[model samples]
Target: MDANSFLMGGGGAPTAKFPTPGTVVGGHITEPPQVEQQRDIQSGEKKFWNDGNPMMQLVVTVQTDQRDPAIDEDDGKRRIFVKGQMKNAVADAVRAASAKGLEVGGILRVRYTHDGEQKQRGYSAPKQYEAHYTPAAAAQLQNQPAATAPAAPPAQAYGQVPPGVNPVTGEISAQAPAGLDPQQYAAAQQNPNTAALLHQVPPQPGPQAGGEPPF
Candidate 1:
């Protein structure tokens, strides 16, 4: 074909099978409100859409007070459908957030694109959209204080100890443990278990030439 005809008709429309138009949405993720699974009509096999893949619908709480027209202040939230077509996009977003040490509570922005008609075996699937996510920096994340190590539990005062026997030393001084007399208590305090053992003295000879037998 001629160059002009090739340029005009051979290539056909530049956007014959174009990507669906999309919009950007920014918010924090929430649990999905609903889920849907589909099966093929002809073969009765499991089937998914959105470029032949299933999607996860996530409800997101949009950042309010930012005056973004895309966000509905009255609703304060929006929904995003994530699918396999945007797998790399979602992974990149998650990696970005992870690199920043962020998590589910972190802010993210997603580009949502709608799907065209798809029909099979006299069955027509409803229109759907897919999400492509990106990490969104927020003032909240930036201004959050670094987690302090619980202030080291406020170093206990000099003589104030927990109300229990010391596990390491195995010492118990709680009211002398019931049945011991004051002397026994003192002795037990000096040597734990001394009160628990009985001692017996054997008989000794009366005396030696210059020394009394000590018993």
Candidate 2:
């Protein structure tokens, strides 16, 4: 191994641990969401659902607030594993930000609100969360000089455009991007910001509906 690599802080951020209920994590997202296959811990095999569909998770890394003791990292970096209801929470947060999906430098805060109703007797109740997101541009505006801040763009009406199309050019694509489903493609086209976000990140399988826990 190269000795210089050690000085460069090569290892990635440690996964953020939710030690208890009501824990809150807030930070600026450092990268786009990463989609990875879910694996069984003991068997070390990829996980699948009852219908034979593969399970997946979205990984998001954030530069956390140093004061948040729950993170417990000197570097204030933490990785969040999002699945099931957590995925929906994060996606909803992103949508509320009025930009796209999770974007680099976006502000994200999530709280472990409570446990959900247990669906099965043996399995634990799913962990529920509340998330909020602020777009990078919007966050930066707070610090920008008033005279230098750019004017906001006018909103465009996209309701008439077909799914998987560009409203400005009125161009429709013949097929969805690789890995995106029809529903996702339709949603992406409906919102230009979402389409831009989709272009930046590779398409991944949609989250599965269940009581899977968030880590």
Candidate 3:
């Protein structure tokens, strides 16, 4: 089996649970939120609400503060399964952060505030939640990594000259350079020994690097 398939054999991160009111969990979102249909625990079948609509839950995986020893092992990751009012609260928080939607690297905090009113007998009241969000930039500032010196450019290979320079004479080539394509070679031939042909390639930005949580 491939590495990914082998890793998938292990169970996912533990689901964050709110045992009682006033429970709070705060962390950085590790990935985009996922919407999945709810399933029955006993039958393992898809579930629906009373109105016959499919029941769905928003799953958000977070790299949480290491405050809870029970589930903070390994990578300190937790999966939050949100539905009902909790989903709405999370959406509002994301909007308050000026984000179009929940995104990876954003900060999120959720609180189990209280229980909703119970309308029928023999039924439990629904749990209610509140949430807040901080954009990635703001969160980075709060837990900024130490600044490091910029890296120097890599040295060119020996005997490997730049496009416009001749290797033997170490001067501008009067003809098209060795590595140019047909089009570029044609253009170079038309403008040989000109400073305009000696273009300096711009440096490209590398992928954004992720930092370890200060938690």
What are the lDDT scores of the predictions, listed in order?
A: 0.44, 0.75, 0.73
Please give the lDDT score at residue 122 for candidate 1.
Answer: 72
Off by over 4 Å in 1: 1-22, 30-73, 99-103, 112-139, 143-215
Q: lDDT ranking from best to worst?
A: 2, 3, 1
Which one wins on lDDT?
2
Pairs of residues clashing in candidate 3: none
Give the per-residue lDDT digits (tens) of candidate 3, residues 1-215: 22453687955566787889999877998877778898887998999989999999988888876546554455777788888889899989988888887778888889999999997899789999999998887888989777898974432344244554555555554443445543464355346474354354322233356955332
* Candidate 2 residue lDDT tens string, 95-159: 77787677787888888999999999999899999899988888778667778767645334425
Residues 1-215 of candidate 1: C-alpha lDDT, one tens digit per residue: 23563677742111111134565655554332233444454895666666978634323344422343543443444433334444345556666545442244456565546654665767544334333333435535665798777643322233233223453454543434345533454454345355343222222234478887645
User: Pairing residues by index, what is the TM-score of model 2?
Assistant: 0.57
| TM-scores of the models, in the order given | 0.31, 0.57, 0.59
lDDT for 96 in candidate 1 is: 55
| Global Cα RMSD, each model | 18.8, 29.7, 20.6
Provide the global lDDT of candidate 3 against the true structure.
Answer: 0.73
Task: Find the candidate with the highest TM-score and give its number.
Answer: 3
